[model samples]
Every structure is written in structure tokens, then in C-alpha cells.
Target: MTTAPIRLGTRRSALAMAQSSQVARALERVSGRSVELVQIVSEGDASRASLSQLGGTGVFATRLRDALRADECDLLVHSLKDLPTADAPGLLLAATPERADARDVVLTRDGTALADLAPGATVGTGSPRRIAQVRGENPGVEVRDLRGNVDSRMRRVRDGELDAIVLAAAGLSRLGAEIDLVAEPRDLAAWPAAAGQGSLAVETRADADAELLETLRALDDPRTRFAVIVERAILAGVEAGCHAPVGVHAVIDDDELRVRAAVYGAQPGDEVVVDRAEPLAQEYIRPQGSGKGADAASRVAHERASGIGALVAGLLLDRGAAELISPSTAS
Candidate 1:
């Protein structure tokens, strides 16, 4: 008997298709099953309103998740950064593949860096975090609201309509887009990226079949998963949405996990930043569910990582992150 192809749900954007295609190929290799892409229109993709106006978080993932819940697809792929910190009913994040570059890049018509851009130069981006970071770096430049796919946004800069635009380097790499503009990658230390940036999330129904679960779990990279979990935990701890002026980046180096987070107030000068690191437990470093002790180890590791995240968030809140990121103050 021939097996049915796995239906992978995804958005219709070029980047989404590219990343989803990549995941499809990987799943086919691991499961020895054919995979097909099922494009789904999300509200975020359909609407022209600013992300903030549409509500900062979950705009992109909601519809695809709905399709999954409705049995329209067997799995869904999402840009993890766009996914809300909150869990959806009946869905589980089955996998987090290896991460890509989690830094923001400045695309300019000329070779001008963001800091070197002439005062009053216009930089386009719709992200509150980018807006605040751009302003903090060079308050003289005029930051303009920008929305659209990567191609359209880059076109504005190429056509001289905007001096530059901030975009995720991971998106560019995934799309493999070719352009005639200069790209400058920002330092993560100075400009932390959104939580879970540069990662791809493979989601599926919580009660998926054992074989399907195992296949999806094969794609999980523990290091990437742990880091993103810690980063996102901080986002959740602070009660901020994905589109808020909050930047959190976590990385696992050797046996240590380090995270840097920032919450920017509406004003350029108003911000709360925190940097913290912790040693990773042995079980988290190893593949998940390798032995009888695996379950207990995974649980403990998860709690410890979450605890560290809460600790950092507490530090920020204690230092006025709550006031800095409050909706009334942040926007």
C-alpha cells in the first residue's frame, strides 16, 4: 500500500514557501514519505494594517493553526519569531530545526551603514523593536513605517523611496534573494533580535500518531530548542507581545546558555536591558528521550531554563521594565 503524502500548511509569502519547502524536503528524507505544501492565507498576510494595530502577536500563526486544527494539514511551519509566546489549544511545537543568523540587517541603496546614514535619512521598518533600536542608534534619522514582503520592502530602498530598511538576516538567507543593495548586519549585543528569531517551528496536533511524532521530533535541534525556549520564556514573563518593542536573543555556547533582552519605551532613551547566563544541564545538551532518565532530565532542564528566564525578567521588571514596556508607555 502506498502512503499518503504529508500535508504541510504554510503562508503564501515567498519566504514562507521557501522555508516550508525546506522543511518538507527534510521530512521526506526522515519519514520516507512524500510531502506536499498547502498554502494558507493568514490574516496578517491579508491585512494592510500595521501589526500593532492588528494586535502585536499571533497575527501570522492563527490562521495556519486553525487549518491544522481543522485537519486541513498534517503539519505547519512558522517563522518562530512571529508565533506568540502563548500556547494554542490542541497544538504542539513539534520541532525547532537548527537556527540561522538571528541578527537584523540594514539594506541600503548605497553602502552606507545605519550609523553613517545622513541625519534625516529615512529608514523603513514596521517592527516596534526595530523602530526603537534604529532611533536609539541614530535618533537623527527619520524612521518610517514599512510593511510588505521582503521583495517589496527592498524595492523601496532600491528605488530611492527610502534610505534603508531593517530586516531579519535569516529571512534573506532563507529566501536566497538576490538584490543590488548593500547589506549591513547589526551586532546582536547592541541590537538584540526578537525572541525565537531565525528559527523555524514545526507544529502539529498534540495527539498526532506515534510515527508522525517521532518523525517530527527527528528534526528538533536541542540546542536551538533550548535557547529559543529561554528567549521566549522571557517574552512571556514580561507579558509583552511579539510586535512590542522587546528584543530577546539567547544562545548556547558550550555548556552555557546566555540571553540578552531589552524592553524599549516609546522614547528613544527609555529602555530596560538585562544580560544573564546559566550552565546547561547534561540532559538538555543530549538528545531528548534517550533513556529512562530522559523524561525526568528533560522536565528538570526545562524548569531550570524557564527559571533563569523568569529570573532575568524579574531583574528587568525590578528595574522598571514593566513601566517601560507597558502598552501605554511602549507605543
Candidate 2:
């Protein structure tokens, strides 16, 4: 008897394909299941409008999810950052595989760091969080809106059209972009990754086949899931979208988990940073008769992380950070 190949849906972009290919290969290796890539072109990819104008949430993920719902695909792969916070009815975020480096790196023309760039140097980025952070670092640098694939952005810098550009380190790595002048953000005030940055979301329908769910669970990493859970929880607690001018990062250090968040208002001067670290002492549960023992740990860890995230978000909001991102509160 032959096993049917699992259909994995992904966006049409190169970076999307690269990431999906990796997951497909891994799934095949671990489960001995053949995998097929189903290319999906998202509205975000087809639209020329700015991401902010598109509501910045679900533009890239919605179509793929629709395909999942229609049973056009068995599984969907998405950049966890692009996956919105609201729970999609009849769908499950089945797994979050091991995360990659979540830092943002500055790519320069002459291999010079951001600090070394001449005053008024044009830096290209499309993210409000990145723009605010870059401007905060160097007030004189001229930050400009940028869009397109990794190659096009890099080409602009190479051709001297842009002095520098800041992009997610994981995307650069996945696309194999040869980055020479790289600068990592060392401070939350200056830089923090978006919630779920550098992570992959494996989503499946609520009624997905049992064997497929088991295969996906095998790829899920508890620590990565916990970190993204806390980060996303902070976004949800703040009632902010994934594309909001907010940066969040979570890390697991041995028995301690630290969650850091930064909120940048509509203006450059309006910003706040909050960080919280706590002991990872969530109660562990091992379900009887289930072959999976780690599932319980994953759920407990996410719960603890969510609580910590809510605490951190509340701290910032109390300090008036909410006004920065809220349209009603904006001056």
C-alpha cells in the first residue's frame, strides 16, 4: 500500500517557497510522508497598496487559510509574524517549528555599520517599528519606505540607490543573501523583533486527519512555541495588529523566560519599552494513553507565557504606552 502525499500550501514568493520547502523536507524525513508544495498567491503579494493600508493583518495569510478551509490543501505554512492574533474558526495553529535568529540586520553599501553611515544617509525599510528604531539610533539618517523581494532591496543598496537597509536576519539567511555589513539591534529601545519573528506556523483545519496532526506535532518545538506565544500574547493584550509599530521578543534562558516589548507611536518621539523575565514553573501534565507526552508541556508553557505577556503589556499601558499606538489616543 502507498501513502498519499501531504499537500502543503505556501505563498508564491521566493522566501515563502524556501521556507515551505524546508518544512516539507523536514516533514518528509520525520514522518516518511511524501509532501507536495501548493503555491498560493496572496492578496498582499498582488496588491500595490502599502501594507498599512491593507490593515496589515491577514493579507498574506488569509488566502492560504481559505485554501486550507476549502480543502485545497492539507496543511499551510506561514511566517508566524504574518499570522494574525485572532483565532481563525475551524483552524488550528498546529505547530511552531524551531525558530531561527530573530534579529534585524542592517545591510550597507560599503559594508559600514549603521553608526558609520554618513549623516543623511538614506535607509530603506517598510516597517514602522524599524523606521522608528533606526531613526532613534541616528536622527540624521533619512529613512525611506521600501518594498519588494530581498533581492530587489539588496540591489538598491548595491547600486548606491540606498545607503543601507534593515531586514529580518532570518529572511536574509533563508534567501541566502550575502550580507556583508550586518548590524544587530542590542537594545529594545532601539530594536525588538515583531511577535513570532523568525518562526514558521503550521496550520491545519480543526478536523484535519489524525495522522497528519501527529506528524505536525512531531515537528513542534515547545520552547519556540512558548516564546512566540508570549510575544503574540503581548500584542493581543495591547490590542495591536502584527504590523503595528510594536516590537516584541521572547527568549527562554534555562529555567527563566524573558519577554521584551517596545511600542512606537505614530510619531518618532512617542515610544516605550517594557521587559519582564520570570521563572518557568508551569505545571506539567502527561496525558495517559496518548503517545505524545510533550503536548501537555507545550500547552502549559504557552499558558504561563501568555500570563507573563499580559503582565508586561499591562505595565507598558499603565505607563501611557497605549496612547502611542492607539488612533483615538494619538494627539
Candidate 3:
């Protein structure tokens, strides 16, 4: 009997292909199953305007999720940062691989960091998060939205459309597209990064085959998973996305969680704010043991992380670090 192959859904972009292939390879090892890639052209890929015009956050992930729901694929893979804050009722984030470099890398013609860029030099990026931070750092510099896959964006710089571009360091490393990156951007005060930016998310439907689901779960990295939740919670709290400038970085070291977050206006030159936090020593905080020890611990940890994130975001907003958000969060 021929075993059914595990179908993995992915976007057509080079980064998406690389990420999807990595997950397929991992799943094959875990379940001894043949895996196949299903490329779903996303709306974001088809749209020519800015991502903000392409529809808000998750534009890149919705198509894959829909395919997963229709049973077209055994599982769907996504860049964790591109996923929206809300979860699909019938789908679950079965796993998140260990995180990669969470920093936003600055690629320039010269071997110079952000600080070394010439005065009034133009920086390129499609992310509002990067735009705000770049503008905030050097008001004298010009910032513009530069979209397309990594190579496409790099092409613009080579064609003299831009002097440098801000890209995820993890992406360049994954695609081996690093010759353009003049330097790696760092400093929470200056450039934090999108929440969950360097992680990958594996989604499986609620009714997916049991053995397959468990096999996929094996790819989950608990440390990275929790770290992303913490980071994403901050993004959700501030309601940051394609149109909003929000940066979040969370790390797990020695079983302790540390998060640094930043929020800025439409242009960083306008205003900016940043903050950091660390979860309490206790694994999770629960009030009077609401349930079984373990269950309560998980609940407590999630709530604590959420609360910490909210506190940091609120503090930043109140300080005029991030601009006023719409009445609704999905803005």
C-alpha cells in the first residue's frame, strides 16, 4: 500500500519555499512520511500596492489557512510574524520551530551600519516597523516603502532606486542572500523588530489525522513558541501591523523570558518610545491554584506574559512613542 504524502502549503516566494522545505524535511524525519509542497499564491503576492492597501495584516497567510481548511494540505506553514493575532476556530498552530535571529538587518552598498549611512541617505523597506525606527534614528535620512521578495528589493537598491534596504537578518541567512546587508540593525531603543519576526509557524486543522497532527507537533519548540506568544501579545496590545510601526523582541535564556518592545509614530521622526520586561522567576503565576498544578501553571504563564506585554505597550503609547491607534485593534 502506498502511504499518503504529507502535503505542506506554502507561498511561492523564495523565503516561503525555503521555510516550507525546512518543515517538510523535519516532518519526514519525524514520521517517516513523504512530504510534498503545495504553493498557494497569496493575495499579497498578487497585489501591486503597499501591503497596507493589499489588506491589513495576515494578507500573506489567509490563503494558506483557507487551503488547509479545505483539506488541500496536511499542514500549512507561515512566517510567524506575518500571522495575525487571532486564531482560526478550527485550526491550531501545531508548532513553531526554534527562533532564528530576531534582529532587522540593514543592507547597504557600503560596509557600514545604520549609524554609518551617509547623511540624507535613502533606506528601503516595506515594513512600517522598520520605517519608523529608521526615521526615528536619523531624521536627516529619507525612508521609503520598498516591497517585493528579498531579491526584488535588493534589485531596487542595485538599480539606484535606493541606497540601502532593511530586511530580516534571518531571511538573508536562510536564502544565503547576505552580500547586500551592510550591517545588522540592533538596539531596542532604535530598532527592535516585528513580533515573532524570525520564527516559523506550522498550522494544522482540528480534524487533521491524529498521528499526522502529533508528528507535526513534534516540530514545535516550546521555548520558541512561548517566546513568540509573548512577543505577539505585545504587537496585539499595541495593534501594530503593516500600517503601524511596532517592534518587539523576546528571548528565552536559562528558562527566563526577556522582552524588549518599541512603538513609534507614522514616521519615527515624529515620536518614539521603547520598553523592556522579564517574566517573574516563577514559571507561571496562578491565584490560589485555580486548577490542577500544571494546567494552572500554563494559564498563569500566558496571562502573565500578556499582562507584561500590555503594560509595556501602554507605557509606550502613553509616552507618545507609538501614535494613537484606531478605536478597533484590527486597524
Candidate 4:
């Protein structure tokens, strides 16, 4: 009987295809088998009219995931940030490769720093997190809702559709559309990134397509993997990090992990309390599951990350960040 080839379901966005290529190359290296990318038109792409009008976070991820469950594709690739915190039935986040720069970059025409962007200058971004932070920094600046791949977004600034736009450095770098940075790219303290920015997730069926799963794991890098786990855990506590304009930045330091995230309320734009946590930095994270059981490293990281997140949240609340909470989920 002929064998079915490994089909990798991915979104049609430039960055999504770009990230999927890495997975394809790795699978080839390990399995010595050809890997094919299946472009899945995700809901996010179809509903490009505006993200704010869409129901919520899952639009970008659900469709590709559906393809995997339907056996139309053997696996899928996703931006860790775009994935919903709520787990999918019969699906697994099998592997997360090394992370990228989990920070936001402020791009502008004059090449001025974020703080230097001319007052009242309009900044383009669809992210609540970036918009809140940007407005907090410059109350007079305008925050516009922008959606599209790196090229489309960048062209806005080039063609003067916008004066400046804020975007994830990782997205730009992966799409090979790097541009002049109006502000330095840094972590949570400097500029908190949308929860899962700069990270990638590889999803497979619950049964773990034996050969495919093993081959993909070879691409997993310990440092970035652990960092994202902690980042995602912190995100979980916040309920789909996107809802609150939440952003997280994490790193491995001295065998100890220092994590930080922000929670902003629905104010016109204000400083949300940014919090920090330190989970022990074990070199790598491997789940110890016995036939559907939870992972050992994930359990440890999840509990520790949330506890620290709560502490950080409390700390920030006390520091005049109580005003950032939203009255109801802003659509």
C-alpha cells in the first residue's frame, strides 16, 4: 500500500509560511522524507475586515487545527501568540522550537525613538497591548487599528498611510521585511510583547504521529522552549493573554528564569501594572506523561509561573495600575 506523506497545515500569511518552512526543513533533516506545506485559509485571513469586529482570539488558529483533526494534514505550525490558551481536544502542542526576539519594535519615518516620535503623530497597530503602551508613553499620539502581513503593514508607513506602526520584531525578521526601528527592541520592561510573540508551536494529533513527532522534536531548542512555556503559563492565568492587552517577556538568566508581563485595562491608554516572576531555570522542559497525563515540567512551570504572576499583578495594582482593568471584554 502507498503511504500518506506528512502534510503540514499552515496559514497563508507571509510570516506563517516563513515559520512553517523551518519546520519543513527540520522534518526533512530528521526523517529524510519530503515535507509539504498545505496552505489552510484560516478564519483570521477570511475575516480580514477587522480583528476588533471578529469574535475573538481563536480565529487565526482554529482552521489550521481543524485540518489536523480531520486528518487532512498530519501537522500544523502556528505563532505561539496566536494560539488560544484553551487547549484543543485530541490535539497536542508537541514541540516549540527555539524562541525569537519576543519584543515589539516601533517603526517610524524619521527614525526617531518611540519617545521621540513627534507628538500627535499617528501610530498604527491592532494590538491593544502595543496601543496601550504607546498611548501611555505619548498621550497625544494617535493609535490606529492596522492589520496585514509585514509587507502590507510596512507599506502603510512607506506610502504614508500611517506615520508609524508598531509590530513584533520577530514577525518582521522572519518575513525578511526588517526595517528601521523607531525604538529599541526589548522585553517586558521596555516594551512587553504580545504574550506569544516570537515563538512557534507545532501541533499534532493526540496519538503523536510516531515518526513525525520524533523527527520534529529534534528541532526543539531547550532555552527558547522553556522561556515560552513560562511565558504561556503566565498567559494562561490571564485568560487568553489577548483579552487584557496582556504582554509577556521572559528570558533564561543564571539558570534562573525571570519573567514579566503586563495587564492593561480599557482606559483610553494608560500604564498597566507590569509584573515579574522568577521560576527556576531548568535547562529543558519535557513533559512526563503516562498515556495522557500532564507533563512534569509543564506542571512545575505552570504553577510557579501563575503564582508569581499573581504576585506581580498585585504589586502592580498597588503601584497605581488598578485603573487599567476593563469593565467588560472589549470586542
Alpha-carbon local distance difference test for all models: 0.89, 0.82, 0.74, 0.71
Number of the predicted model whose lDDT against the real structure is largest: 1
Question: Against the true structure, what is each candidate's TM-score?
Answer: 0.96, 0.92, 0.87, 0.86
TM-score leaderboard ranking = 1, 2, 3, 4
Ten consecutive residues with minimal summed lDDT in candidate 3? Answer: 282-291
Please write out the lDDT profile of model 3 over residues 106-163, one tens digit for every residue: 7776666776677888888777667767776676788887778888888877777888
Off by over 4 Å in 4: 1-4, 178-187, 240-243, 268-274, 277-323, 327-331
Residue-level lDDT for 147 in candidate 4: 86
By lDDT, is 3 or 4 better?
3
Q: Model 2 misses residue 134 by how many Å?
A: 0.8
Error of 4 at 279 (Å): 5.4
Cα deviation at 97, candidate 2, in Å, is 0.7
Worst 10 residues of 4 by lDDT: 283-292
Model 3 root mean square deviation, Cα atoms = 4.0
Expressed as tens digits, the lDDT of each residue in 1-331 for candidate 4 is 2245678899887788999998888877767778889999977898776665675567788888878889888889888887777679999888788888777877877776667677778889887777778877777788888987787887888888788888887887788875753545644676778766788888899896566656666766656666666666655654443545777777777656676766665554545545454646452454333333435655565565556555655565566554554533322
Q: Which RMSD does model 2 reach against the true structure?
A: 2.8
lDDT of 2 at 306: 79
Better of 1 and 4 by lDDT: 1
